[model samples]
Target chain A: MDLIESYKEDLRLIRRFGTGFWIVLLLIGLILLPWFAREYWVYVVTLIFIYSIGIQGQNILIGYTGQISFGQAGFLAIGAFTYGHLSLLGSPILVNLFFSGLMAGIFGILVGFPSLRLKGPYLAIVTLGFGIAVYQVFVNSEILSGGRMGLTIQKLQPLFGLSQMTTYYYFNFILVFLFTLLSYNLISSFVGRAFIAIRDNDIAAEAMGVSLTRYKLLSFAISSFYTGVQGGLYALLMGYLEPNMFTFLETITIFVAVIIGGLASVEGSILGAAFVVMVPQVFSNTKAFIPVIYGVTILIILIFEPLGLSGRWMKIRLYLRMWPFR
Target chain B: MPLLEIKDISISFGGIMALSGISLQVQEEKIIAVIGPNGSGKTTLFNCLTGIYHPNEGEIHLNGENILRLSPDAIAELGIARTFQNLRLFMNMNVLDNLLVGRHLHFRKNPLLPMLRIRKEEILHRKIIEEIIDFLDLQAYRKARVADCPYGVQKRVELGRALALEPKLLLLDEPISGLTSEEKEEAAYRINEIRGRFQMTILLVEHDLRIASRLADSMVAFYYGQKIAQGTPEEVQRNPEVIRAYLGDD
Candidate 1:
């Protein structure tokens, strides 16, 4: 049996030293992966890291805050374009990334205004409209987004005598790590509780002193910020920006990641991102059947593992902990 | 000055008046039971006071401040906490988290501090929550999700949530409506202990007259959106209109 000696122990993210050791070992493996793996696999893993950041953002809005958003691609485009434009203007890489997230977060607040009075499908439609509008604007605005021709970004200056690819990989790895840590901290606090409370029962949440307007907008802003950062990373990785890149299909892919990863979980986001990224690679030879495979996998997960892969992992861990007994 | 003063408060839905010109005064540290038949606007008054519904006319003063203009959360911050007729506990959260949510207002609002795992403030709040858990005798279910809890235990968790706010005025709508006799007795005893231990002013809406009159310092009776009687429990029980409201006129 688990015994929590204090509230601090109860609040710990990694409760046991064994878990911490394993996590550290896993992180070390991830850090050294680029040296041993082929460049193609390294590239795929980098894309997974970027998508993981965005998926965590979606999880916060849909999973933790109970807000349905289908316009995450809009925020992604905003981040990508912001990063591209800022980098072209000779801004520092860090500053460009920060502005990318900040710009998307500002628009997130704008989308959140409609959510004050709307819920469920109505809110989803509004966000979907937002995603389409963003795509159209980028496609039409020649000066802003290069108008269908797309923008190209220069590679980063290699750091610590590492190869350019490894540098980019490390940049993404550090960011995903920091963002995951931040999400974990945010989820365990009073703000996180307030978000859950609003999700479960909004009226009671208001009565309990949680301002609906403030927290709802805050959820949107934070979620979009994460997606925006991912967009910046994506732009850096691809070295190209096109309006068609941030399509409605991309938003749905991110949503599927949240569902398959498990809602309100950090590890779920990472696992979900890896699953989505790897599945397409697995079916690369028969690209036409990718969608069908995804559908079947999702159906199976929903039917048998409703809590998703993370939940299933947890159950397996519990069973092993109670081995030799049914 | 009275702790809470309701002056000619009236609310209407379409054409139906839920409450009309209902006025009353509640002094500090007193239990005032509002005993009324169903559809008599007892819950309506609680909603208006908590700022869930905007009254078309009249004023509500808490600690001598006009509260009609404040939003529900603003009123909550002004030290008014309530429990719903139907339990509104965060169903997915554990009991400990539910009580911690009650202390939402008390926790600092800096998003960055908690994100860094700042334990000083959280530990302080947890101490208060532990005391509430002890008071409510919810140790066994402390980590259990609110949805998994038994009905009677859920009721105590609801009460514990309200108490966690440490409000000056506590509004309880039907605190013991659905419970076994033994649970009811335990709840009544706890309700009495709440007033004394917390030194809080309670505005309770209970249908059981025996428990209501036993625990209340005074009683108010409502009928058809108007106050029919207001006085000592025995005095309100003796009022002819209150008698007619409960039983058919003969």
Candidate 2:
């Protein structure tokens, strides 16, 4: 049995020595992956990292905060286009990423305003409208999205004798790692408690002195900021920006990742992102059957494990922990 | 000055009056029990005081400052904490987390500090929470999910959450309504102890007149959205209007 002698120990992210050991081992594996894997596999894994960041954001809003959002793609689009324009203006890549996230976060707060009064399907519809509207705006505006021809992003300069792809891969890996830690810290703290409290029971939460307006807007800003950064990374990855690339479908895919991976879990976001990214590649030859496979897989997973893959992972851990008895 | 003062407050839903011209004063460190039948506006009075239901007319003063117009969170920040008639604990969160949420107003708002897991600030908060857990005898159930807890334990958790706020005035709505006889006695003992221990005023809504009268230094009886009687528990119970309200005119 794991015994916590102090409150600090209880609040630790990796409480157990065994868990920390496994995490360190996993980190080593991730560091070695790019070297051993083929170029296609490396590219796929990089896509997973980018989507994982975005999925973490979605999980924060929908999973932890209990706020429904269908406009995640809109924020992603805003981030991508912001990066595209800033990079064209000869700015540093990191600065462009920061500005891209900042711009999207500003829009996120704007979208979060309606959530103060709207909930469930009403909030969903408003966000859906936002996603569609963002796509339309980019398609129609030439200066913004290159008038349907789309914008081209400049390639990154490789550093320290590494290939451009490897550099991009390392950059994303570092970001994803940092963001995951950031989110874990966020959820475990007072801020995360407020968000969960609002989700579980807003009335009691309010009585406990948690401001609904402040935290809801804060959740939006933080969630979208992550998605926005992911969008900037996506722009760098593809070296192109099209209005069509960030359609409602992109939002749905992210949403699916959150649900299928698990709600309110950082590890779930990574698992879900990997699943969504890899599945498409796995069925590249049979692209038409991808949707059918996705639908069937989601239904099957939800039916047996409603909490998603992370929940199953937890059960497996629990079973192993109680193996001799159970 | 009284810790809380409600003056001629009235609220209505469409045409039906939920609370009408109700007024009361709560002194510091005293237990004032409100005894009433169901739908007698006891809960509504609590709601108005907590800023959940805005009174259509009249002013509420907390420490001489007008608070009726403030939101629920604002009222909470002004040293008023409450328990719901129906339990409103965060079911998905663990018992400790539910209490930690009660310490929401006390924690620093700097997002950066928590991101870094600043040991000093976090340890301070955790220390306060640990004390509350000990006081409420919730150590065994600290890590247990609130949903999995029994009803009596859940009720204690609700009370513990309010205590974590460390408010000046506590409004408890049917705190022991659904508990067993043993749990009821235990809750009553805790309620009586809380006034002296926490040094806070309490405004309690209860259907159990016997327990309410025993716990209260003073009692006010409500009947059909109006105060029927107000005095010491003995005097209020002896009043003809209170008797009529409870026992009926026939």
Best by lDDT: 1
Candidate 2 lDDT tens digits, A154-175:
9788889988888888999999
Q: Could you tell me the interface RMSD of model 1?
A: 0.7
Report the C-alpha lDDT of model 2 over B1-250, residue by residue, as the tens digit: 9989989999988887888888999899999999877888999898999989999999999999999889999999999999999999999999989998998899879878878876567678789988888887898999999999999899999999999999999999999999999989989999988888889899998888889989998999888888888999999999998888878897
lDDT of 1: 0.93
Those runs of model 2 whose alpha carbons end farther than 4 Å from true positions after fitting are none
Give residue B83's error in model 2 in angstroms.
0.4
Model 2 achieves a DockQ score of 0.87
Q: Model 1: clashing residue pairs?
A: none
Residue A26, candidate 1: Cα error in Å is 1.6
Residue A179's lDDT within candidate 1 is 93
TM-score of structure candidate 1 = 0.98
Docking class of 2: high
Residue-level lDDT tens digits of model 1 in B116-175: 988778989999999999998999999899999999999999999999999999999999
Question: If scored against the real structure, what TM-score would every candidate get?
Answer: 0.98, 0.98
List each candidate's DockQ score.
Answer: 0.88, 0.87
Docking class of 1: high
Total backbone collisions for each predicted model: 0, 0
